[model samples]
Target: MLITPDISTLSYKRQLAKRFDRASRSYDSYADFQKIVLDRLLAMLPLSQADVVLDLGTGTGQALGILSQQLKPKCNIALDLSPQMLTVARERFSALPNLHCVCADAERLPFQEKSCDLVFSSLAVQWCLSPLDLFNELFRVTKPGGYVVFSTLSQGSMPEISQAWVGLDSQRHVHDYMAQDALLDCIKASGLNLLSSQLSDILMWFDSPEAAIYSLKKVGASLIAGDAHSSVSPTRWKAFLREYEKQRDERGVPLSYQVSFIVAQRPAIV
Candidate 1:
């Protein structure tokens, strides 16, 4: 049976899709950090090659080239929430007849049971409303003995943004990443055998505070925690900048990401 998300979850995903659609054109340009994370995630794959591979949340199809060239999957599926992003991916991989683009929700994968040999996602699972549901779908679709490799932001990500908004406003201005322990628990609960997991801190340097924040939005990742419709006053904006500037150092303004690299697999039948 297909998983059915509640009404609110569906609405939230639509909003996320629209925001990402707007960022589709600019996503590749500002996705340097994403590429870094993707590379690390790909390096954790358990198999050298697979018959079928699914690239979840493949924004602008960055991983398509590497997956197709190196892993050489017979069929490569590039999936995302944004239609525009899928369009870009389709155009980029138009020459590759085996590459297919699908717009779908991660929590409710459209694939049949035990269909994919490799389910890979980079910096994407964190966006789902329920990590358990996301992993359940991953577990369901992955062929027995197949692997699932992914990278997601964990707690302590974007410390600068969280700190800067401390006194300026009561609302949260940054995304609240899930704790590593909770994520691990979800993986276990989903019945996927955990192979290995690692946590690392990645820091990016930007010329200024504006550039640092722009990096998030350009990638369609700047989902704030407060009221979306609330307007920020000039004074508050200035205060936020002032607070953020205090963290600048010799290199430039800093944005931190606490990344969790995970590898899991479905147990093979005896």
Candidate 2:
């Protein structure tokens, strides 16, 4: 079973939204890793046209241009939990008349059943309370024979941060990312036909430890599940920087992520 954090509360959800909303302006500039991962996820899609495509957790709508150009969908729906993020998306893609932006939760999508011909998300669903609930929502909104493609962080992501915080405090500074097996189990249990999945480590190098950590914060990914409101003291924060500096090698400071890419399809009714 996936031991997820207690992120189901309304207050926690609000905090999450606020964080992403505040980061909307800086997200695109600091989201180099996200851009790379989005390209990889897009490559997994088959060359085909669709009437409607849903971009779940479409933060800043980075993939909207590519999805519209490639799929040639009649309508593109960009959904996210942060209203500010959607505002940024709407302004950025104003030229695309077919594009629509909606602020909503991924676990409880606002779309009708069998409404979207394709659903695509990248580096987004892991923030949900439960992967099973998320996948079920995707299966529900996706039309028969339609596809769902997504990429999420897996276990053992950002080890450098955890390693640096080892002695400073044990208050769970890092997010408890789900294990690969647990994530696969959720997909299998969601009733979407498993097509193909891949697990790999995405390593990012930074000039300094502060820059590496700031990258996460600028993308609104710095919040831990249960400890979103806490702040680290300057002393402890400085100590953490020193410890992280010890991890430096020829490639400067390193931050790593274990990412899982998944592709599934809703079965057609006989």
Which one is best on TM-score?
A: 1
Q: List the residue pairs that clash in candidate 2.
A: none
In model 1, which regions exceed 4 Å deviation? 1-4, 225-230
Instruction: Give the alpha carbon lDDT tens digit for every residue of 1-270 in model 1.
Output: 855667988788888898898889999899989988998887777788889999999989888888888788999999999999999999988997588888999988889999999998999988888899889999999999999999999988988887888977797676778999999999999999999999999999999888887788888886473332245777888788889899999999999899999999999988
As a whole number from 0 to 100, the lDDT of residue 227 in candidate 1 is: 30
Mark the regions of model 2 whose C-alpha exceeds 4 Å error after superposition: 1-8, 226-230
C-alpha lDDT of residue 186 in model 1: 98
- Model 2 Cα RMSD, 1 decimal: 3.4
Best-performing candidate as measured by lDDT: 2
Clashes of each: 0, 0
Q: Score candidate 2 by lDDT.
A: 0.89
Writing each residue's lDDT as its tens digit, candidate 2 over 202-223 gives 9999999889987888899984
Quote the positional error of residue 117 for candidate 2 in Å: 0.9
